[model samples]
Structures are given as structure tokens and as C-alpha cells.
Target chain A: MTRDSSSTLPAPPALFDTAVVAGVGLIGGSVALGLRQRLLARRVIGLDASPEVLREALALGVVDEIQTAPGEWLRAADLVVLAAPMRALAPLARDLAPFLNPHALVTDVGSVKGGIAAEMERLGVRSFVAGHPMAGSERGGVTHARAALLENAVWVLTPTDHTPLTALSRARTLVESLGGAPVVMPPDAHDALVATISHLPYLASLAMTHMVARDERLSLLAAGGFRDLTRVASGDPRMSRDMVVENKGALREALARFRRQLERLEADLDEPDELLAAALEGKRTRDSLPIVKRSLLPQRHDLVVAVPDRPNQLGAVTQTLGAHGVNIKDIEVLAIREDGGAVRLGLESPEDVQRAAGILAAEGFEVRGRS
Target chain B: MTRDSSSTLPAPPALFDTAVVAGVGLIGGSVALGLRQRLLARRVIGLDASPEVLREALALGVVDEIQTAPGEWLRAADLVVLAAPMRALAPLARDLAPFLNPHALVTDVGSVKGGIAAEMERLGVRSFVAGHPMAGSERGGVTHARAALLENAVWVLTPTDHTPLTALSRARTLVESLGGAPVVMPPDAHDALVATISHLPYLASLAMTHMVARDERLSLLAAGGFRDLTRVASGDPRMSRDMVVENKGALREALARFRRQLERLEADLDEPDELLAAALEGKRTRDSLPIVKRSLLPQRHDLVVAVPDRPNQLGAVTQTLGAHGVNIKDIEVLAIREDGGAVRLGLESPEDVQRAAGILAAEGFEVRGRS
Candidate 1:
């Protein structure tokens, strides 16, 4: 509820004297745009191995200065964000250690965090915060970068025990000014969570793409469903490869669990009862997702209620939830039967579901399912 | 080129004396609506084991007559469509044989064709056409059904070698009247193709959902890409399970191929060059799909062009294609560079891609990739 848009950000021109954004791609360029648009930096410096991209970033006004080899820029930078591929963050830490002012805050926008934090610890990048802005598009490059790219997105920061509170607050402040909802987590927890949500899907898409890529007949017959299922498969190969490679441990675990679940479904294919139950489970799980809300995170309970067939049944249920201060995100008549139909209510947050369910059940309503 | 929208369809009342749709689900109800909307059916009858669905379908005006059982209505039927799940198709055939007139046409709308075709054959149903309307949504039910559901969609008919020409023509005419593009193929081929393109992705989604559904943290952080990738996974569990079960052989094969491709990419994660190439290949294949146009099926070739950096470069390319009568469905600058960048063009069909590419290349444009 506290999340605000970037348009409301006050000019914070002295937040950082000179900030460097390495590898000026979409995410990197967005960071630069946010810094400039919010006036958080006096000068935003761009650094990329691709000279053409660096020049384009400069021409697009993504940065006030371009760092060709990172000597003077790194020495002058009050903050350095390694907005490069996941694989490059640790190695770049050592490369920038010599030039970086010992007091300057160093962080990154890598998908994986724990290993990167550990690697940075080994590389002696002491003043560092592991960060990831969960805002991106299938498109890449500085041309697509927008100042509001991070608006309403989750910006996760993973600070180790060695990190100071000042750095965390600084990162949180920047995230907020750029219209991001900042969430703090342990580095490993962040890695594990992203692995399941992001990396696992990337690989799933990749596998499915490769599967159907060879089937010309199937590709011709492919419909919207298949297209949607594999849309992320068209991601930049290098970046995708880097994510899996860097987060191998977490991704491997997720993939293994995915494979096991698939095998279980495959086995249950012959058992109609089990298959139907699993299929319903899939529906319940999917419906439970807080897709209707614009939360930086998913927070909802899919509460299935069996309401008696009466004139004011649905109205009574809504009034009850309203009185309990629980907001219903979505409500659907999932099934209709003789005695009462099953109404699935999506409530904002698990706490809301419990409170609303308690109120409804106490009022002689049948609470069937919550996922 | 001959494709037309349903709005242009003539209202030819009394095209068919009697038409019955078994199982009043989305597809079944849509068929009845299309038939009635196009004025192709004078009297449309509905039948479903579930009396509630039958009653709803009637109330929705999807059918004029309701058939309690396959008794009297089928004997007078000019056309009969088994619109139930795949598992129910064979039994319905047997149940209808006694009532069906010898000359009456029988068809079905099952996702998997071969197994159902075989089952019908075993049941001695000779006047059958296996069909699949390549039109569907994540949501199902008669309430969601529309007369225009099949408009501009592919209605594939899989007629075995034993099928009569009259039955095939009848099915094609009905599909066309419903504003669908009719394509004919053998039943087994249809099954294999759908297994790879549709069933494989369904399983992949199921595996992913089951995998991450247990991970509350990942579900919280699930983003748009993940949602789209898993959208198909929330399908009617019974329908999804039936698809995989009926076409288990082909699905298993596709799954194996997918697993192999994944393993290959997994092995080459350390090799950046190989992984990047594979990723690019994935993009190329995905881009090749006709995502822009609403074709009966995916038919366009994705053409990649390297155009010189100029203000009128894009306009010139579009003008050239316009002059050649090659309609571009979608065009995007895939990558940007200093003097020129890579542009991907989605042409309506492969012929258009070849013609458009020829014109562009002859004018000194570099055609980089075509798939």
C-alpha cells in the first residue's frame, strides 16, 4: 500500500555524485534512466563492453558520461551497479575493485544472488549490496529503456551480515524513488525463490521450444496456447545461459522437482480419479494466483465457499467480508449445484482469507476449499 | 486468401433440417451457436449426460430441441456432432448408431484424432469425420461459447482412407459455413502433430505448476512471463488428462525429445558460444511462427533483414513490400547497431516472405535470417 509512482519522486540530485551502470542493456539503461529522471545522480556514467551499445546509450541520453575502460569513472563513482549478465557480476567485482573508491557502494542487478555475494566476498568487494530489479521485457537495449520501467515492480536487495544498515537504506531509497517496492531477503533465499519462479520457467520454455522446433508439422499447427507457453523461449541466449550456469544449484533442484511432478502426473494418466484430482488441483493452484491485483508480489487466498441457494446469499457473503475489513480481489461461481453453488473468492493476502472464512463459517456458511 | 469473417456469412435458414450436438461444453455450444447464427440449421438439438448443462445450454438458446437420450432425435438427424471429451467419443458412437440414419453424417471435435477415429471404427461407425477446431480459451463452458468462436480459426478434419467423399465434403462445408478454414489430414498425423504442439506444452505446464505450486515464495514472485507460460496448464484437467492419455504414445515421444534437447543445452551451459547459438535458434523458430496474423493456423515465415541506418529505411522497406503485393503481418527491429540493425518481418505466408525478401535483397538490403 505504501508503493508510489516515480512521477512523485522529488529531485535528489546529490544522492550520488557519479554512478556507473555497467553493460548498458535494457535493465542497465533503465537504471540509468531512473537515476537521471529522479535527479538522484549528478552524473550517470555508462559502461559496456559493446562500444556500439555504449555509444547508443550515450546518444539516447541514458548516461551523462560514457566509461570506455573504467579507470577515471570507477575512481569517481560514489555508487557502481554491475547491471550485466549473472555470470559476469562476480568476475567484474574483482576487475573493478582496484579502481572503485574503497568507500563507494557497489551492488549488482543479477538474477542470482547468494553465489554472487559469496564470490564478491572472496574478491574483497566489501561495500556491496546484491540487488535485482524484477522489471524487464522480452525486448533489450537502451532504446527500450524508460524512466518508469521500474514502476510498481519488486526491487529485491540481498545484504549479507557484513553489510551496514546505511547501504541497505540507500538501496531501498533509490528503489523507491524509481517506483519500485523494495523487499529485503537473505541472498540464498532470493536465489532459491527466483530459481523456482524465473529460471525454472526459462528452462521449461527452452525445453518445450526445442521439442517443437524440430516438429515442423506441430509448429504449423501450434496455437495461441503453445505460443504463450513458449513465449519466453525467445529470450537472449547468452543471458539465459548465464542465469542457468550461475544458479546451477538452485535451478537444478527446481528442475528435478518439476521432472518428478511431471512423472507423477504421467503415472496418474491411467488413473482417472487421481488425474481428475490433480487436474482440479492445478486449477485451484492457478486460480489461487493473485492475477487480478497489481501487488509487487502474489498475495491472495483462493477461498471456495458453498453458498446456499437463496435470494441474498452472495450479497450476504460480500457484506460479511466487507465488514471484516477483507478485500475480495475476485469472485467467481466456480460450480453451481442444487443445495448451493461453489463460489471461489480471491481475497488479498492469506490473513484476509482466514478472517473472511472464519466470519463466513461462523455465520452458517460452508467453507469448502482454500488454496 | 479466400478466408472471410462470420459477419459476412449469409443467414441461410433451413440449410439443415435437424442438427444435434452431444455434450453442451464450450466447443459443442459454440457449434450449435455457429450453425444457428449462420442459419445453417433449422432445428438444433442439444444433449448432455449432465442435465444441468443441457438445461443451461437450452436457456442460452444454443439449441432449440433437447434430446434426453439418443432415441428419436438421432433417427431424424441430418448431422450429428459428438462434442464430448475424447474418452466419451467411442461410447457415444455406439449409443447413436441405432438411432442414426444410415445417410446421416457423424463428426466429432476431439483434440486427439487417431485414437478416437480408431475407437469409432471399432464401434462400426462408418459415417464419421474426426475434427478439431483450433479455437479454444483457458476458460470453458456453454456460457463462454459464442457463435463467432470458430471464426478465422482452423477446423481440421481427419478422415481415414475409408471415409467417403460426401462425408468429408459435408464436414468441410459445415466448417466453412462456421467461418473456419477447413484442412484435411489422416487421423494419426493429426494426433501426432497435436501431441507435439499442444499436448507436450500442456504437460510441461502441469509439471511446472505442480513444481512451483508447492513453493509459496516462488508463486508470490511469479511474473507475467511465468503466468503466460503456465496459462495453458490451468486447462480443464479432465480434458488435459484425456489429451495426454489418448495420445500418450506421441506425447511420450515428444516429451522424450524435449528432455533430450534440454539435456543437450544443459551439457553445453559452460560453452557460451553453443548456448548462445541454441538460444538464437530458439528465437528464430519462435519468430518464424505467424504470431501477428490470425491465420487458420501458424503459416507465416519470420524474415530477418539487416537494414541500413536511415530515417526512411523502414518506410522504404514497407513501400517495397507494398509494391510487391507482399503483406507484412509484423515487423520489428530485432537488434540495433551503429549504421544498421537486424529487423524481423513476419509475412503472411512463406511465399510472401520469399517475394518480399527477394525485393528487399535485390535493393541491397541484407536478408540475415529466414525461418
Candidate 2:
């Protein structure tokens, strides 16, 4: 019934007098915008090797102040986000080390955490919390950055053994202030987990794409499933290469595990039960994963309704839900037919899903989905 | 400026007096609807073992007549489309052979083709044209059936050496009339291609999902890329199992090819250039895949515009396109930022893309994308 684009997360108490976001690319620019929009810091500064990027950030109001490079200006900051490319993170942190105030809690938005945390420690940035916001776009750079990119994103904060409690708390507080879910874990654990969930998946997609490339005609036959399976392969090659290389140990282990699974599947081709079990297991696990909505806030519960493919069917379904006082967080036309169609409605809560399903079913709509 | 959802392809002349579609499931129902809507046949007779399905098809107006099973009614059909389960195709063809008119051209909509083609050959259905329509939905059954499902779809027709030229020509004509792009290939070739592009990718997704399911926390950390990579894993297990099992030989070869690619990636992890080269290759191939639009009609050309994240930015872009006499075929909000956002506009032709890009750039908008 309502389309609220505004933030619903509670305003946070101002945590910093100043925050410096280095690099001013997608991640850094987004961090600056989030700090400014959420009022997490009084003054936000942008630092980048490129003056043009800094000027763009300043003109866009992503940062209140701009710096061509890290300098004494960092002393005024309570927070510093190192969001340069993977290769540049250590050097940027090392350059800012002497200028940073003792109380300043530094963090980063790197895909790999253990290497960066160790690098930061070597650079004497003691107040460092390695962070990875599990959010991105195929498009990169500040021009494609937005404060909303962090909204309800699972921001993993990997704290090393030597990391100060105050630094970790401050980093978590900043992540929370930006409307990101702060998930705290050890650096090695974060790297290992991401290797399975993120890095290995990217490699698999790339490998699959490569396999398809062997036969020029294979791409012509690839349907929507193949496109979706290999979507991540189109991401920046240098960046993907850096992540995979940095986490190669964990990635190799994950690849071996995946290979074993394929072997099992290939061996059990004759026995439909094993294949069916694996598919069912996959479906169950994938269904259980939280559906990331536009805002990525309070999870949305979805239900599919089989409606007659006539005029105003969608209007009627929405109206029926509206009458029941159920707000549809998201809706999509999954398939269209002249005689019948399937529409998926995303509700805010499980209770709302139950209520809407019961009401719709009574109204002669066949509804089914994971609530 | 114009939004025409109507078929642009030439209207098909009535090629069949009566077309019989066996098993009114999603594929069968869609085929029947396509035949009727496209005026490819004067009448469509639906046949299924279940009277309930037959009744539903008749009630839905997807067929002119309904039959519980193949019998004397099949003698009137000039075209027969076996759109049943993969396992049921051969037996259904065998059962229908006794009643089918000698002039009737037979075809199927199975994912795998070689085995089915050979089985049809053994059944004395020498007129069979094995087909695999690369169009499907995660949702199945007649409820989600649509005539548009075949529109612009790559419908592969694998005609065996013994297949009659009349049958092959009729099959291709029917496919074209349904707004499908018919691709003719050998049965073994079709199976091999789909195994690499469809079946193997499905297994890879399934394997990745299984690997991720090993860690309960991994899913929590998964972002959009992971979800998309594993999306096909949630498809119908029974159907997916049948597909993989039926095409086991080609699938096993595809699996081995994929493993070799992954092994190469693992070996080259330490070599950034090699890894980067693979990623670049994958990116190039993935990017080259055609964008599938809602209508799935004539191919649409795309361009990305970096618009300022201000109110009415999208409205202004559309208005600009409209003023320039360019119609947007498909539009998507790729990313949003307070200062900038990436909007991808799909135009009807490459010329339209060039003109629109130049016009937008002249109007102070930054546009970049594949043409």
C-alpha cells in the first residue's frame, strides 16, 4: 500500500567529528555519501590519487572536503575508510599511518581480509578493523556510487587478535550507522568463508564462461540460466583476479570441495535419487537465503499466485492484498499467459504472507511459495 | 516513441488443418497456445492421459478439442507436437503411430534430443523432428503457459538422417510461425551443445550450492552474485535430474571440460596475468551474449548513461529519447547515487543507439555501453 524510499533505520548518535574516506571510488565514495547522509560524522574528507576524482566527489557533495593525498588533515578524523583497489590498500594505509590521530579507528572495504589486516598491522595502523561490505555493482567508480549501496548490506568486520576493542566497536558502530548489518568475525575466518561463498563462486562462473567460450556456438544456445550463472564473470578482470589470487588457499580448498560434489553427481547420474537429493538440497538452501530487496532492510517474504491471464489481474491481486491491510514490499510478473499467469508478491513478514495467502486462496487465487 | 508489443514477424499462413499437442503441461500448453494465437493451425487438439488436464486445456481455450488419450482423433491432425515429459515422449509417439495419418509431421520439445530421436526412429515415427525450445520458466504446468514463451526463442530442431524433408520443413515452418528462431542441427550436436551450456552449468550451480550449504553462515554472507550463480539450482529437481541423466555422456564430457578450466585457473592463481587473461576472456564472452528482453523479439541494442542522481533524471532521459524519435525497447536502473546513477537504455536498433548516445552526450550526459 505504501512505497517508502526513505530510510527506516534509526538515526545514529554522531560517532565522529571527522571521517576520511580514501580512494573516492565506488566503495570510498559510497562510504563518504553514507557518512554524510546518515550524519555519522560532522565533516567527511575524500582522499584519492586522482585530483579529478576528488573534485568530482566534492562537486557531487559526497564529501565536505577533498584531499589529493593523505596528510595532516587525517589527524582530525575519528574514522578512516581505506577503500582503494586491493593492491593500493596497504600503501595508502602506510602513507596515512603517521598522520592519523592515535584514537582514529581505521577500516577498509577489501574483498580479502587476512592479508590486508596483516598488512595494516605491519604498517602500524593498530586501530584497524578489516571490513568487507557484501554489496557491489557491475558498474564501478564514484559516478556509480550511492549511499544506498550499504543499506542493510551484511558488512563483515574481521578483527585481528591485536585489534583494540575500541577500534572494533567504532568500526561496527560506523557500519551500523550506515544501515549495514555489522557481522563480526576473525580475519582468517572471514577470508575462508568468503572464499567459499564469494571467491570460489566467481571462479566457477569464470570457468564456466571459459568452457562455453571454447565452442563459439555454445553462447548462442545459452539461455537465461546460463546468463545468470555467468553474470559475475563480466565483472572487472583485474579485481576478480586480485581477490582470487589473494584468497587462493581457501579458494583452492573450496574448488576441491566443489569438484568432489561434481564427481558425486557425475557418478550418480544413473541413480536419480542422489541427483534429485543434491538438487533438492540446493533448492532448500537457496530458498532459505534471505531475499535481498531494494532497500535490503527487514526481509521480504514472497508467495506466488496463479491468476487468470485476463485484464486487471495484477490490479485485482494488489487490491485484494490492499483490502487485507497487507503491504506488498515487492511484486514481479514471473510469467504471463493468455489463460493464466504467475505473479510473485513479496510481503514484509511471515505473518503477512500467511494472512495474504489464506485470503487470496479464499478469493480463488492459487498461492504457493516459501514464506 | 512507440511501444509495440505486437509481433513484428510476418504472419504465418495456416500450415496445418489440425495440430495435436500431447500432454498439456507448460511446454505442451504453450505450444498449443502458440499454434492457435499465431494462426499456424486451423485447430489445436489437446491430448493427455489425464481427463482433468484435458478439461483444463479446453476450459482455458488453449485447444479447440480435448482428448484423454491418442486414438482415432489423431487421424485428423496434420501436425503432432509431443510436449510430454522427457521419459514419456517415445512411448507416447509409439502409442500414436497406429492412429496418426501418414502425412502428419511429428516433433517434440525435449531438452535432450539424441536419445529421443533414436527412440522415435525405433518406434517407426520416421517423420519425427526432434526439438528443444530454449525457453522455459522455473514455474511449470498449464497455469504458467503462454504463447509468448516461444517468441524469439531459439528452437533447435534436430532431424535425423532418416527424417523426411517434408517433416523437417513443416517443423521449421511451425516454429517460425510461433515467432521462434528455428536452428537446425544434428541430434548429437544439439545434445552436446546443451550439455555444455545448460546441463553442465546447472550441475555446476548445484555443486556450488552444495559446497556453500556445508557452511551455514556462508549463505548469510552471500550477496547478489552468489544468489544469481546458484539460481538454477532451485529449479525442479526431477526435471533437472532427468535432463542430466538423459544427457549423461555429453554432460560428463562437459563436466570434464569445466574441471580442466577450473584446474587451469587454480594452477595460474599465482600468475596474475594468466588469471587476468582468463577473467578477461570470460568477461568478453559473457558480455557478448545477447540481452533477452521481455518480448524476446528483434534484438535490442543497449547503451549506459551516467545520469546525475537527481529527481526526474530518468524522466528527462526518456523525454530526450522521445524527442529524438527514438523508442526505448527496455530500460533498467543499473545503479543509483546521490550525485550519479547508471541507467541502461535498450533501443530497437544499433543506429538508434548511436543517435541516442550522441544526442544524450550533446545534452551533457555521459553515455557508454556496447552497441
Which predicted model would earn the best TM-score?
2
Residue B275 shift from truth in candidate 2, angstroms: 1.3
Q: Write the per-residue lDDT of candidate 1 for residues B239-335, one digit (tens) a residue.
A: 7877788888887777777778777876666676787777888877876776722663454365666656656767777887787788888775544
For model 1, residues A1-371, the per-residue Cα lDDT tens digits are 11122222222124677899987888999989887865557799998888899889989999998876767558888888898777777667767777988777888888888887887788777778889888887678789988667766788899999887877877876676565778899998898787777887887777777766777766766757777777887777778877877887787777777778877877776776887787777777775665622464454355667666656678888887887788989886643445545566877777777888787777766674332
The CA lDDT at B179 in model 2 is 59
- Give the TM-score of each candidate: 0.73, 0.76
Off by over 4 Å in 1: A1-13, A49-61, A86-91, A164-166, A292-294, A297-371, B1-15, B49-61, B296-371
Cα lDDT, all candidates: 0.76, 0.81
What's the TM-score, to 2 decimals, of chain B in model 1?
A: 0.74
Q: State the iRMSD of every prediction, in order shown.
A: 2.0, 1.7
Cα displacement (Å) at residue B247, model 2: 0.7
DockQ for each numbered candidate: 0.35, 0.44
Point to the candidate with the largest lDDT: 2
